[model samples]
Target chain A: MTDVAVIGFAQAPNVRRTDGTTNGVEMLVPVFQQVLGQTGLAKEQVGFWCSGSSDYLAGRAFSFVSAVDAIGAFPPVMESHVEMDGAWALYEAWVKILTGEASTALAYGFGKSSAGLLRRVLALQLDPYVVAPLWPDSVSIAALQARLGIEAGRWTEEQMAQVAVRSRSAAAGNPAAQLSGTVDVAELLSRPYIADPLRAHDCAPITDGAAAVVLAAGDVAREHCARPAWITGFEHRIDSGSLGARDLLAAPSAAAAGRAAGAGTVDTAELHSPFTHQEILLRGELGLGEQVTVNPSGGPLSGNPMFAAGLARIGSAAAEIMAGRAGRALGHATSGPALQQNLVCVMEAR
Target chain B: MTAPLSAPLEISFDYTRSLGPVLAKFMTALADRRILGSRGSDGRVHVPPAEFDPVSFAPPAELIEVGPEGTVLTWSWTDHPVDGQPLDRPFAWALIRLDGADTGMLHAVDGGSAGQMRTGMRVRPRWAAQTSGQITDIECFEPATQPARQSAAEPAAAAAGQAVAAGQAVAGQVADGAADGAEPVTMIITPVRLGYQHTASTEESRYLRALQDGKIIGQRCPACQKVYVPPRGACPTDGVPTTTDVELPDHGIVTTFCVVNVPFQGQRVATPYVAASILLDGADIAFQHLILGCAPDEVRMGMRVRAVWRPPEDWGTTSENIDHFEPTGEPDAPYESYAHHL
Candidate 1:
């Protein structure tokens, strides 16, 4: 396999809403410029382009295609899109580089979660015939998972509250985060439950944002940056979709992906845990010990921009290595209800 | 910058599905107020029966009546309800393991309060006031008011192809899910509705603003120098926003077109009209518009045409301000001039 390293990463400001259109061109234009500028690579020199986004978020079909306008794709560049999160798109770009198709590639994702009732819209991802018709909102589903773990003695309500407290406090340093401030665990615990077992603080804010990452193979990666987060392993896995079939407290998919990706003890970890308890479950599943620093970038609970948040996790992890913050880092992304799908990328400074 | 023009947009569709034999049997049984599940190869009965056995990877051979009464495995209370849920009032959503079934199915439980809901509480399917053989036939599960007792025919009844279960709430239950032997619920229709606030990009908004003034405006790409009417947010070739707005005449030549002989939903024009891409005078790109005032057969590529505007009073920030396009009676432009657009 080619030695592909993340050469640059950039993201738009995470916020509850943006005045931009759903196609994401406005959110993407600035980030594209920022990522290219960070790598000191010209747009014409990049070889391949891929993106992740969803039509459901846009409420229009082929919305991602219109996002290409941000790239000014005239003379048509080689491009592809996935309805999945941008982390999966990054996987596509990584494969493109490994296959020797492109020396340098760019991957991006964006979502205007503010365009629709986010939690309500997400219900569409469930089983249409059996599950979706009931119209179980996303928060309610997560609440179900949280209650299961709590009842199973896997985690506690206080521990879940602590996760939120830590995330918001940590997010104080991240300008791209949507929710950040000093918060007390007890104060969060006292808050009324939005969905029985879950509180407002326990849920990631609905954010509209975009993120981009640039990758290069071997020598180009080395020449462009003094430090590159070299990709050691990238793996993704998925479990059964039925909500009743699998154990909710255990994210078998994340555990399997983490094991396959060699997500060993790392100095830093950027996990995509939209719910507070999910962070605890993921930490146990991925085998990240207490010594490992988690969500210094505040993670998704601080600011989750749907399809873009997962990709930003990878980029944020790479940024840590690029900035000489850690020797090795792990970035994890999840999709579907109760973490049914997961992708793990382990990176090291070189 | 001023906020881009925005409007509420609602997209809806009715997704039609055809259930296979296994689900067909399961759904058809539900209409008859019975609960059926597929007995997996491992001897575990699955509720909302799996079409194929997860372990064996084969179609389930046995269909069993699990329970109308069951225990709540896990539940979360919904204090505030959203649209389309089984219950509009406050309720608990639970996973219920029905009698004689090893696996559980998710359904709403009308427990009324958080204190009343628990992991081990007993519940029973509250048959809908009316059932149509859909999963919603069980409107929701309700806490069982009667004592929980084991049914008699539970074990051998399923293997015997009996639709009745033992020690369950079902009494005098009809076994005929498909008495006429008609194809079991082969089709189901689900209506999907979503709402969004659609925002026009800044450049598109600018073009729309121009349309309100009864003028045609195009923008020039700083790098490629191509003119785009209804200017795009960024130039396709240059990766830059078009900044220099240029005004052009409404008259142009049709680069290409198609005669719409077939009709579709929400089409305003009658059949046999031409929808053409018009290359506005001095603009490098063409935009779609209707061609009228002539027979559809006469609408040809490279033909000269001009916009026919609606009365000025009716004009707004919309391209609909132009009713259609009509021929200028001038000879067609040379095909070479607009060939690149095609």
Candidate 2:
């Protein structure tokens, strides 16, 4: 097996709504060109193309099919899709390179979350036959986990407020972030709860966006960029959909995936936490010490773009390793209701 | 131009789910207004029993009477309700561990505001005004003020692990054709309806706009001299966009066709018609359209046809503006001329 590294990455500015359709062709066309141009590669030279999206998110089946026009895939390119986050799509592409399938691959994810009520669509992810009929809004589920942790003394409202504060402060530096600002916990605490024990800031803003990442095998990586963020390890797992059968306050899937991915003692980590309390739960589960810088790209709390947010996490973490700023970094992604599934990827600068 | 318009569209279907045997027994019990739990191969009682144990991957056989009362394991408050939620008003969603059962179930709780609801609070099932095999059979779980009359089917009093001894006592009261705790028998049909504006591609859009002016336009692919009636992003064979515009005659010969004996979803026309793929006089690719003014069996390959337009008022930016194709009254083109198109 050969090593694959991130050679180029690009994303559109996160926004409340994009005039483009939910299929994501309009948004993907320019980014596809930008990332290819950055690496000095043409569309014809790319070896593999894969995407991540969901039918429930777009309110239709085979939603990703029409987007192929952006690539002008008349000759039929080698492609596959996962009804998961784009970070997982990148993981699949990375594995292909490792198995010696192709030297270069492109992975992308796009969602128009603003098209439908996002909270409503998310209900479909729950146990469809047993639980989904009740239609539990996602915020309420997170709040239930938040209150349990608060009662058990695992964390506090003040501590959760601090995570939100630092996320926005770091986000102010990212031009693509839709929401950012320095906020004081005292002022935020005064606000009313959307779900008890959780404030609006504790939740991510509904966003619509697209993102792409380019992966190249061994020599291809060195030729495109001076410093490459070579992948060291990756793993993912899923827990039963029965929310009652498992512990809600902690994520076993994240812990298992992190350990399998060799995520230990990294200089920085990018975690995907749509809710503030999840960040606290995930940090302890992944065994990240206080020294590791987390969410320097503002994370999902500022602008959670559904399918694209997870891939953005990988892109954000790779940026640190590519800039010669970090030696080892970890990128984590989650899906299903209340983090029922998880994935972890570790990369090191070389 | 007209201002764009929109409306709420509900794409729904009953989704006929075939519950082989395990799920059938469960649904039948729900119809009898009873809560039945199935004991899995692992000795765990699962509510709304699963078809197979996820871990053991085997069918569940044992049965237990659970619910009517349970304790909340974890509770979440829904502040902003989404479409199809059990309650439009604010409510608490909880994981309730039913009495006499080993596992828990998820449902809505209506015990007042956020402050009153606690994780360990006791609640009872609130049956719906009507009974069905669906999950909606239980309206919501609410605070149980006092002990209610317990159903005799509940063997909670007979002592635990009495499976062999207790089977005879409960056998008499079992509903006719009920599996007790196996699976439910019901068919739910979920209808899927999706609507799209179905915009034409940039090249096709230009061709349609020109059609409104009664000018037939074709674009010539640079790699191949073949003309494309509706220009494409890339040639299907050579993989390059058409670069030069060319004029073409609409008079084309029928390449091939299939008879419409069966009606299907989203059919725009009546049955007993012919849908033919026509290769225009100079174009390389074929397009699908309806053939009329002839018997279904008479519409043969290489039959010459011409566009039949609908009244002008009904015309818009759509190929449907050309109602159907009618016989040109000219001699049928020779089979040798159009055989390759087939």
Which of the numbered candidates is closest to the native, going by highest lDDT?
A: 1
Q: In candidate 1, which residue ranges exceed 4 Å CA deviation?
A: B146-183
lDDT values for all models: 0.87, 0.76
The candidate scoring highest on DockQ is 1
What's model 2's TM-score?
Answer: 0.84
lDDT of 1 by residue, B1-342 (tens): 777898999887767776667767777777677889889899988888888898998999889888989998888888887766767678888888999988768888888799888899999977665455677777778889744333223222221111222111111223334625433565566667778999998888888889999988899988899999988887877777787899989999999999999999899998989999999999999999999999999989999999999999999989999999999999999989888889
* Chain B TM, per prediction: 0.87, 0.74
TM-score of each: 0.94, 0.84
Residue A321 CA displacement from its true place in model 2, Å: 1.2
| Model 2 misplacement above 4 A | B1-9, B39-44, B54-57, B146-186, B189-257, B277-287, B295-306, B316-319, B327-342
A1-350 per-residue lDDT for model 2 (tens digits): 68888888888788987665666776777778788887888777778888888877776668788666666675678887888889889988988888788899999998878777777678777865556655566787787778878988998989999999999999998888988998999998989888777888889888988889999999988998788888888899888788766788879999999999887768899899998989999999999999999999899987778898888888888888888778899888999877889899898986
